[model samples]
Target: MFTRRGFVKLLGGGFFGAMALGGYAFGVEPLARLSVARYVLTPSRWPSGLKLRIVALADIHACEPWMSTRRITSICERANALGGDVTVLLGDYAAGMNLVTRYVHSNEWSKALATLKAPLGVHAIMGNHDWWEDRTAQKNGGGETFGHRALAEAGIEVYSNRAVRLEKDGSGFWLAGLEDQLALLPGRKWKRASMGGLDDLDGTLAQVTDEAPVILLAHEPDIFPKVPPRVALTLSGHTHGGQVRFAGHSPVVPSRFGDRYAYGHIVEYDRNLIVSGGLGCSIAPIRFGVPPEIVVVDIG
Candidate 1:
């Protein structure tokens, strides 16, 4: 009953739809949710009083289809399974200003995130995306007002640029966070109080006793060089390991330093920097070579 041209068009449309669905089912959908853990052991001259196993999850740009309640629950379940003493969320918990409103307006997301538990409790910092994107008011002026409140209610402390101390086994470490360097962009002036000065390593160290190991958490890996030598280890997750790496190369990274600040462990002088690939996508929703990561750092 159909014309030859119409029949061909129908067949072509069906074929394309099948291919699209197949691709998602076999490729993108599977990658939409994944968990990877990288382990590191830190040996220090100080007494090995605490075998602190901290799990770091960062950049969960939570949005529909890609980042959802199921995905978050999966991440939490996996982290709990790892049995980490402390869980640290590096930043960029929401996708962006617009998407966050679409998702985080209700309390469901926050309540789900609250389920994540750690013996030492969970600590967090704000990523550039959170400050620049999520906080931007749209035409409606309805921005992250509720989302920020939700995160706070969920018991996740959002450190703009501050430090908190954690004590265990008679020893303690300093955990400091800084405002996003991207705040350096035009129109968004980062408060001096929120942009902790890394130029004075000795000054920052003065705040904490040398006996306790210090761990600094910054959202971007570009801040690595600025960190003080006194910081035993620094955890970050902005680069996303070049979300779409290819053939031993990460072609796309958000850093100005390019591959120099790509991913993995980098040690310079006495400072150690661990750049996590992160657990979510940004800019582009597809990930090729880069895989989501959950980092575990064992400091003894």
Candidate 2:
């Protein structure tokens, strides 16, 4: 029932709409948006009277003009105001994409992060990018990377397949961190055809000598299925909510589980996982429906 002129107008409108959407995704969301995604849960088997507040920052991917040191300091200030019992850095602090004006060095970014304050102190774990981007560490087949050293010098504890027991008001719980799941990439120097990881889930959990409920920090949510019931909650951020979610789904997800572990609160078999959309771009500087976020988890 449309005339030729109307048809042409419809085509032109659609073209401009697509261009507008692309512009917003590329130029606006990833650069200017920061949101808070919060989750409050009483996980099965979590102790009744022990309440904990955890503030988490993940996938920083620091670079000039995108995630500058000034911006990171502002983010840290905001996190401190949240008054979490503990602060956790979920890694990927290095630049994740080539479309950057300049990469923010580890020292600059770590120094900015040093301003964060929490009662239980700040704990960290490395992400795949933290491992993959460190050429010397990759070549050495698991030695200290600049990322680890920078974070350590900044007074943050970087956990690598390790566990630590923390106490709050006469109650204690364990914080376990797993190594990056995609730590090793295939190359001639490595002499491997497939990607391998340094993550040690079972070994890390075995460090628990008592019946304290545990909270696990992993870079990627793909490990959720393998997480045992002993862990009251699991936190991760690598997927970035697919970085460009649309219609309640991301067209392309970096995870092996596709959109299954893409973002937000996921509970399976009484094991809870919260995946943050994160605070920087990866592969490309683009974001649409899913904006950058700082995740807060309150658990009992």
The lDDT of each candidate is: 0.69, 0.92
Model 1 accuracy (lDDT, Cα): 0.69
Best by TM-score: 2
Tens digit per residue, CA lDDT, model 1, 1-300: 799999999999999998886675435733564656566667454456677888898888777666777777788888777878888888787674242324533266567667778888887766666554544522223223344566788997755556678887777777776655554224333423332222233444556755677787788888777776667888889888887666756877888789877888888887888888888777756665666777877777
Write candidate 2's Cα lDDT for 1-300 as tens digits. 899999999999999999999999988899888898889999987788899999999999999888999999999999999989999999899999999899999999999999999999999999989888998888987877788999999999999999999999999999999989888888838797877888999999999989989999999998899999999999999998999898888889888899999989998988899999999989999999999899999997
- TM-scores for candidates 1 onward, in order: 0.78, 0.98
Question: Pick by lDDT: which candidate is best?
Answer: 2
By summed lDDT, the worst window of 10 consecutive residues in model 1 runs over 137-146
Please give the distance, in angstroms, between residue 73's alpha carbon in candidate 1 and its true position after superposition. Answer: 1.6
Instruction: Give the C-alpha lDDT of model 2.
Output: 0.92
